[model samples]
Target: MPEVKNEHIKAILAIVPEKPGCYQYFDEKGTIIYVGKAKNLKRRVHSYFNKEQDSNKTKVLVKQIRDIKYIVVDTEEDALLLENNLIKQYRPRYNVLLKDDKTYPCIVIKNEYFPRVFQTRNIIKDGSKYYGPFSSVFMAKTMLQMLRELFPLRTCKLPLTPESIANGNYKVCLEYHIKRCLGPCQGLQTREDYDKNIRIIKEILKGNIAQVSNYLYEEMQQLASNLKFEEAQKIKEKYDIIENYRGKSTIVNHSLTNIDVFSFDETDSSAYINYLHVNNGSIVQGYTFEYKKRLDEAKEELLGLAITEMRTRFNSLAREVIVPFLPDVDMSSTVTFTIPLKGDKRKLLDLSKQNVKQYKLDQLKQAEKLNPEQRTTRVLTTMQHDLQLHALPVHIECFDNSNIQGTNPVASCVVFKMAKPSKKDYRHFHIKTVVGPDDFASMNEVVYRRYRRLLDEEEPLPQLIVIDGGKGQLNAAVDALRSLDLIGKIAIIGIAKRLEELYYPDDPIPLVLDKNSETLKVIQRLRDEAHRFGITFHRSLRSKKQVLSELDSIKGIGEKTKVALLSHFKSVKRIREADQEEIWKVVGVAKGNLVIAGLKQASDKIKESKEK
Candidate 1:
């Protein structure tokens, strides 16, 4: 290949195996920049240089390869697992980066004579049993509290060896006095009983609470049959507690056990995956994580990577896994992949999907919170993609027309810069050329006048223009842009009021975005703002016209006289309510008498019309 200039890379490619394996690419400094898994090492490695890469990222990655290395495996699953390990170990620049960094807490039963149960973040390989890497420490602590309440396990750090207890070297602390512990250190509780309780605790941590509840119920019944009323009452209370905890843990049918559910959500540059570990119908563990993509990885590929990563991280051993879709991974015959439809399994899958979506949203909100400019860039990027625009719409303008039965017709133009309303740049237009309630004509006139003025003044044109009506008004605005040869210069869209459908110039079918999409929200805001501004201007003009016609038609009442009357009374209705004595005090009796006589004549005409 012409692009494969490195002699060393060509040499490694010549002898690479045809078996399933992973490959790593290195730059001039001999640092690995990319790692990839392939079913056939030779074919996948050669495929990179064999064709003209479509993705700019892939093309750049291919150009930086100076050395190549491959490790062959027996199966595609093994290759994927190995690739995941190598990526974590090296964290290559061109590999999908796992974004999780915090270590969650786990409840551990420490390896001791009488094992101590507590919450810890560190996992030691000293034969101690660890229940969970719980989502939060609060959850771990809650489980610990429940266990301590159910069984009086020791809460002290004193050594509980048989020798120490036999010699009476340890003393029972306040925990034993309060009956919170069985005083195992002082030999008051035998090791056998404590170990029995530990076994039941393990079962509970595994989400097998029903088993423990059944055992407790039988014991409580035995105690009551023996006529031991007080002891039986205590056992009954423990049984009830176990039953309540079990009810809270059961999320689905008990038959749904040892299952792993996965769901996927993604954006342009990243993929998010949620995992739910269900045991005996209960969600024992759940996690959602993000993968920052390096290349244009397919959904199936990313899903495969995520499944491998999580399964290894959690050490999941379930034979059956529920997923939204079958990932492109080759597993052994022992494991089964299920795409569930309309059942408890489907409910778990839905829950997983919901979690992934919420996680994606929260991650975005947090990032935008830290960097306000990021939200603007993201919104404009979404707009650019949805509208199929060639560039970001940093500056946008929307037009709307308002008229009450063709009276006081006016139009408004609202400006949005960086996806926010630019109030100072907003403009209002009175319908000069159009004399009726013709929205199409008014839109055309306003658009032409607005842009023509901007063109004359050598101002920068907006990247997008939104017309607040469907096909007709949109076409009118398009014609205005065409007159100035700006049709292809700016992206324009029309939004219909009925369904919020978006219309383009040539495309008859409108593009409807998701209801929650930022692009749709911004467009809706612009349309609503333009409509509000136009309506406000229209109302003011109508009110002004009504005042002029009523007061200016009088014989002696001129501009100054009209201002004096309005300034004193604030409104015509109030002036009409005032008596002649009140009017005389404001505008002098001579003009005031004429004003009172004129207003009284107008009010009498209105009353006569209503009577007819």
Candidate 2:
């Protein structure tokens, strides 16, 4: 703003009063750029121009400020709340913007005689009843499904009146045949029965499930007494289903009637709130929401704004509210707020707190996914905790032995940097020092060769080493580290495939971590990767060795001839399948007949075995 450094702003700053208040900054175009609150308006407003701001955003905000406005409040909380309202109304440029204007889910009873009970997001000004602004849409749908099962309410969208039914304006569909509906549209069910079911549904929606359950139980018993076993069984199924859903959803198991519960957690630029609507002994609605803080507003101020917005948006008319604390807002005479000190109400608040905290954690994890370094740090930290290691495994190496029936033994060392496979850093060992399919010996040799090179070359070593085997392999790998006087410098553990048991050297008992733990998953990933790498290399060697042995068995294929035939045909199977002329060309004419005859003899033996 050209007038940012002008006399008017300076004069206003000079005359700014000392009081708790909200302030707004305007740019050259007369657009509000930022809004802020402070206990002492003069000092807070003056500090912006007097001190150098560290944040680029703040500095830019000051540079654009051509004019300022203020509103004084009696208390600091009032200043906070006023700031929130101003920022939201103007959506000031420098404010932290809430991207999700979250709308809650509510079960709406449509105004029709046969009211449609289903979840809706908005409360339209139609003559209808809304039960809850539920915290979860899934919870609302689940409740609706249970209610449908119990009442067999109409699913069709037809306007059924006495006159329409008398004129035969509707036909009953498959809902009646399947016993899912009482055919209210076609007058197979009376208005009284349908209205009665609707009333019962409303009662249940208001957390009066016990009354409905008792009525259903008594009805089921009456039907069973009349030998209507099929109908009785259907009623019993619904009884189980409704009770099961109630048992799962009702956390505290007792009712808190007509109350709204709010719990919160905060982040750098946001406040998160979990809202639960309790009626009778059940939570009928739940929702977690976030509000952006403009000008670094206090939690209390942000929370008040969120509560007002949510209540207005959801049309909540609960007489009582359970909150973490009383917000700085004018209260209506009809509504009272409570901060529970003990018992079930306290439990409900805690549940809401836990929800918002978890929601905040989830948001952080989502951000971490976009940042590789953050994800790496998280994984390493988790690994350290789960494995009880002294340090983070910034660089991790896992070893797996691969050999089949005492032949072509090999081991692989797979390296991971920040919980991700570092393919170029991976190493394959040919097991030169170990004879036979000795996995333990192979592990020892590979470990020795790996760290010994790192030691000689003055390269950094991994903080953790994983051996893909049970205790024996772990001991063998540890011995190699011990040989280099580096056992204590690094952490090593072994994973057994069968049970995924983790073994530490010199410890008799293995540590079993939860299957879902992040640390255990990382270890499992490293182990599986090592096994795959080693098995690939081992299979290649075995295939080459087998081909060499088979080609060497051919009578005319001497060492040089064998090499020529192998190179040309690639394998014994290829040589066997080749035309005699092709074989003659590779082995030469003089020895071609002998080679063909030997091949025929082998083929005959294989055919005879299969025939038997």
Give the number of the best model, judged by TM-score. 2
Candidate 1 lDDT over residue span 1-612, tens digit each: 456778766656655667776688899999989988899887999999888989899999998888776654445644554465466657889886431233446678889999999988676768777655553567678778888888998867876788999999988888889999888888899999999999998887766778898898888889889999899898888777777773222143335768988899998889999987776444555667899999999999999888888999989999998989988787657569999887568777877786687667766765676688999998999899999998899999999999887788899999999999999999999889987789899999999999999999999999999999999999999999999999889999999999999999988999988899889999999999998999889889888888777787678888888898899899988898888898888889999989888888988898999999
- Give the range of the ten consecutive residues with the poorest summed lDDT in model 1: 246-255
lDDT of each model, Cα atoms only?
A: 0.82, 0.78
lDDT of 1 at 432: 93
Please give the lDDT score for candidate 1.
0.82
- TM-score for each predicted model, relative to the true structure: 0.51, 0.52
Among these predictions, the greatest lDDT belongs to 1
lDDT of 2: 0.78
Write down the worst ten-residue block by lDDT for model 2.
246-255
